[model samples]
Target: MKRLILHITVIAITFVSLGTYSQNNAFKGYTIEGDSVVFTFDVRDYSKFTQEYTGQVLDFTDFEIENVVVSGEFNLWSRDHWKMNRVNEHLYQLKKSLQDFDDEFSYEFKFVINNAYWAEPSKEDPNITKAAKNGRKIRDVYNLKMYTAFPKKDGNVHFKLKGYHDARKVVLAGSFNKWHESLFKMKKTKEGWELTLQMKPNIYQYRFIVDGHWMEDPHNTNKTPNEYGEYNSVVDIKEYTAFKLRGYTNAEKVILAGSFNNWNEHEFVMRKMDYGWKYVVPLSGGKHHYKFIVDGEWIVDPNNEVKEYDGNGHINSVCMVK
Candidate 1:
């Protein structure tokens, strides 16, 4: 009996580990795993560390760092707080949840050395941007960027405008940046003008400013009328979200039905796993009501706590794609 119990515990542990790995995605500098974000800092990237607390300077080759902490707007720029986990002699890591940050914005941060020095990144780094305080920019202080992981995507989104090759300047503006006129400058390409952004999945309305003239995307037909009587082109970014129904391993089959697909019962057949059943579907941004049909019986998601009354005397699970 003891041996059998041990075997059961091992199987449970294996399924839990597999579930975790399937949900998390890691990239350079940071990783977005479900609602958690992990940030990595490598001391090898810095040439020198200037200690403000002790007025000491240490070179990368000859010095020792006793501790490392992360300071940024998230912690109100408090140095010596938020210590990182030391992975090796040269690497450090920190993890935080998506609840700790505001959605859809980039946070400026820097690594601290031994609770004293501020580690600065090279200005040429793409993720390095200037620091600001009280509405004024702090010149010469460069910081690293951390973004909220919602509306997640694995890659960059490309925006292009054709037939404007002769234009002097082109800018990409929309709800992403509150329609800032000159923030997102598009480069002139052989075909036209183009710009790429690391945007999260959501519906965004955008327009092109060609030589100071605001115009919608001519190549795209998905547009809506604006308050100015003109039209704005729309783009709906979507990401694959996995839904899993745990337990009920004896069930013959499971089907995934959601409002995104008009709640068709037979459309999405879930793949059976050791722990349960799983299905991955690309869904657009916003709230979606879904349920699982198990062996021809309708049921709400067992693991999800967010559910709503459909007003038809039935409760349905809700998934919000931010």
Candidate 2:
């Protein structure tokens, strides 16, 4: 009886361990980390395919991979633009920033082997999608699943509208989506409507469309006048941009000034770090020109490469916000 009880306890523990492993490692071919998206292609996840041009069946194993590249609409479907790094015998991976892609719900792409054959998902797979060109479907070409990633952490923005329970649809349209009327639909909640987006730091103007009627956000008082004799809601989604002046530890004071603040010399005092002086400030979209004032001596940013003339025959460092 003692031996039987010990055996039962071991089986229970084994099942629990297996269940936990299965839940955590359900491979999805991709992972999103904040602003970066990592695309992974595992040979074991796909099935055998026949090369249409060569009429040769390709069986992918750990030893069969020569090279792999990711082709998609973002790169005009080029066969060799974005190459993947081999992580192991069967895994090929590539990483890209969110800024590298245009604003879209999803994108279609496939992996290319040896820059010749396309690695496709099986028809039964949910990631499999038909490829099309010029509004016509292509034959014998299947793409992997639509892949996309959203920014997390500091990039998340939430918008809500209250007391529109009877409306059929509430859409959030703004400069982010080029003011498309139906692209971003809000979900109805117990309170009202809500939609969250991962957006870069910038100033944007938006309005809510409730059942085909457009109106500014009632709950938000910040607004700007539009040409149509109405007001549009405004939100400044900003990120902290850091400016540093290295090797200036002995300076009595350091100030940060730029085009964002009309070159005010008194604002944005820099703090001393271990290496040098630093200051972080929130900024909106577009280009800004700035310099560091160390001991009241004006100098351009030594670390930044991009610079431009300020029309007064003086050169200033430039920082672009996207």
Best by lDDT: 1
Q: Per-residue lDDT of 104-161 in model 2, one digit per residue for the tens?
A: 4356677777877767566765445566551222235766543321212222466668
Candidate 1 residue spans exceeding 4 A from truth: 1-38, 42-65, 73-81, 86-91, 95-105, 114-120, 130-142, 147-156, 168-187, 195-199, 209-214, 224-232, 242-281, 293-298, 303-314, 320-322
Instruction: Please report, in order, the local distance difference test score of every candidate based on alpha carbons.
Output: 0.69, 0.68
Q: What's model 1's TM-score?
A: 0.59
**Model 1 pairs whose backbones collide:** 151-201
Instruction: Give the poorly placed runs of model 2, Cα more than 4 Å off.
Output: 1-31, 40-69, 84-92, 97-155, 178-183, 219-232
lDDT of 1 at 8: 8
lDDT of 1 at 263: 91
Worst 10 residues of 2 by lDDT: 12-21
Give all TM-scores, in the order shown.
Answer: 0.59, 0.62
